[model samples]
Target: MGDPTPTNPQDETSTQPGASPAGWWGKLRDRANQLRSARRLSRWFNVDDDKVAEILAEVRQQLPTTEALLVGKPQAGKSSIVRGLTGVSADIVGQGFRPHTQHTQRYAYPSEDLPLLIFTDTVGLGDLAQATDAIITELVDDLSSSSSKGRILILTVKINDFATDSLRQIAVRLRQQFPTVPCLLAVTCSHEVYPPSQAN
Candidate 1:
C-alpha cells in the first residue's frame, strides 16, 4: 500500500492538524509510526512477516525439557525421593540439610522413550526460604525444549516438622505461583520421626 497521505501536511502537527515536523521526541514517536507503516507494508506483500511467526516458536523453544521439579527445603529428603525414583544410592547422591542442590539438576527417568520423564532437583526453595526464580526459570526453559508428559513438583518435609511455618508458607507460595503445576506433599523420615498415629 502507498503511504498515508495526510489531507494537510501542516496539520500533521499533533498526530492531528498543525503538528510540527517531528523533533527529537516526535522523531522517536514517528519512529514507531514508521515501524507500523513498514509492518503494514510487509502485510501487503512488501517485506517478510516471518519474524512475527517466530515468537511462539521461540517461547516453545524456551520451555522446559523435563517433566517435573522436585523442590523442597534443605534436608527435606528430596534426594531420597530422587534415589527411590532413579534407584540411585544416597552415597553417590549429594545430600544436605540446607540447599542440598545449589542449582537445578535433571535426572532421567529409567524406563521411557524421550527420557520418559525428567526430574529437576531444585535448591531448597521452600526449605531455605530462598527465591525460586532461577529454579523456576530453569524448569520453564526445560519445558520449552522437551515434551512435558507429566510434571511432578514435590514439596517435602520431615515427619517431625510436617507443619512448620516455612513448609506451609512455601506450599502456599507454590500454589499461588504455579496453580497448574502438579504437586505432592511428602512427610519424610516417617519411620524414625513419627510412628503410626495409633502409636502416639
Candidate 2:
C-alpha cells in the first residue's frame, strides 16, 4: 500500500492519534443532543401565548352556544355519539361528563375555557321500577331551568329495539314535556337491524 489510504476526517469511525474512536456511546450521545435541540426548537416555536389566546378567543366567539340533551337507554351509544360529534377520545368523554343529577350528566366540549356545544346525557330509563319517572322528572326540571333557545333534545334508540313500549312512552313523555324544543331521533346500532326489504 503506497500511502496507507488517507482516512476521511468526516467518518465517524475515524480516530486520531491517542484519541478514541466514536463508538455506540458517542452515537447515542449525538442522538440525545439532536433530540434536545429539536425539543428546544419545538418549544421556541410553540410558545406564543398571545397568539394562542387570540386564536382561542376567536374560536370561542365563533362557536355556537347550543345545548343538546341526549336521552337514551343504557348502552344506547350516548357517549359514543357524543365522542363522534365532538371528536373527543373515549377517555376524555368519560372524564368530561359532570353529573347534574342522579339520572343526568352534562359534558361540555373543550372542557377548559369556552365550550362550543353542551351535551346532557340522561341515565337509562325503564331499567328500575321508578327509573323512567325519575329520569323524566330530572330532565324536565333541567330543561325548564334552561332559558337557552338553542337547546334541543336528542333521543337515541336502538334500531332493533325501536318498537319497545318503554321507548315509545319515553318519547311521548319527552315530546309532551318539551313541545317547543326540537327532538332529533338518532337510531343507533343500525348495523344489527336488517333492512326494510329483508323483513318479511
Candidate 3:
C-alpha cells in the first residue's frame, strides 16, 4: 500500500525548530496589525485616560532615586555596563553624560527631566598621563556627597590590565571615606584572559 498522505502539511512545517505557527511573513503581518490596533487605541484614549495616566504618575512618584558610581581605568567597559543595566542606547549615554566635576561625569536615567536612577563615571585611573591623586580626590568628594542618597560603587577593571596596587588603594580610600556605601568589583573582558590551568 502507498504511504498515507499527511492530513496537515502546514502543521509539519510549523513543528520544526525556529518555525512559528504563523509563517515568517504571517508573523510580520500579525505584528503590524497589532501595532495598528495599538495606535488606534492610543488615539482613542489619548493622555485623558485618567486611570492609566494616574497609575503611571503614582508609580513614578513612588519610585525611589538611586545612584551608581562606575570607577575604572580607560577601556574598562564602564559605559557598556551602564548601557546593559539601563537598556539605554550607547549614543544616549554618550550624549547624556554631563561633567559633574573635573574628573567625573553623571548620566541620569530617563534624562534629568525625569530621573529615577543616576550613573556616575570617573576619569580613567592609574594612567601615567593623568593626575591620579586629583582624580581620586574628586571621586571621593563625589561619593561622599551622594552616599546619603543610596549609592552603589561599581569598580570595573579590565582582566588584561589588572593593576592590583591601584585598585587596592582606591578600595581602601573609599572604605575610609564612605563606609556605608557598598562597592562591587567587576572584571571586564574575562573571556580574553586565559584560565590558570591553560596558562603556560
Candidate with top lDDT is: 3
Worst 10 residues of 2 by lDDT: 12-21
Candidate 1 C-alpha lDDT tens digits along 71-109: 666777877887886676776455322232455665555
Write candidate 3's Cα lDDT for 8-38 as tens digits.
9788777874487456767788889999999
Top model number, TM-score? 3
* Candidate 3 residue 103 C-alpha distance from true site, Å: 0.4
Candidate 1 ranges with C-alpha deviation above 4 Å: 1-66, 92-102, 111-114, 126-129, 132-147, 194-200
Q: What C-alpha lDDT values do all the predictions have?
A: 0.62, 0.79, 0.80
Candidate 2 TM-score to native: 0.61
Candidate 1's TM-score: 0.46
**lDDT, candidate 2, residue 30?**
86
Q: Which is superior by lDDT, 2 or 3?
A: 3
Alpha-carbon lDDT of model 1: 0.62
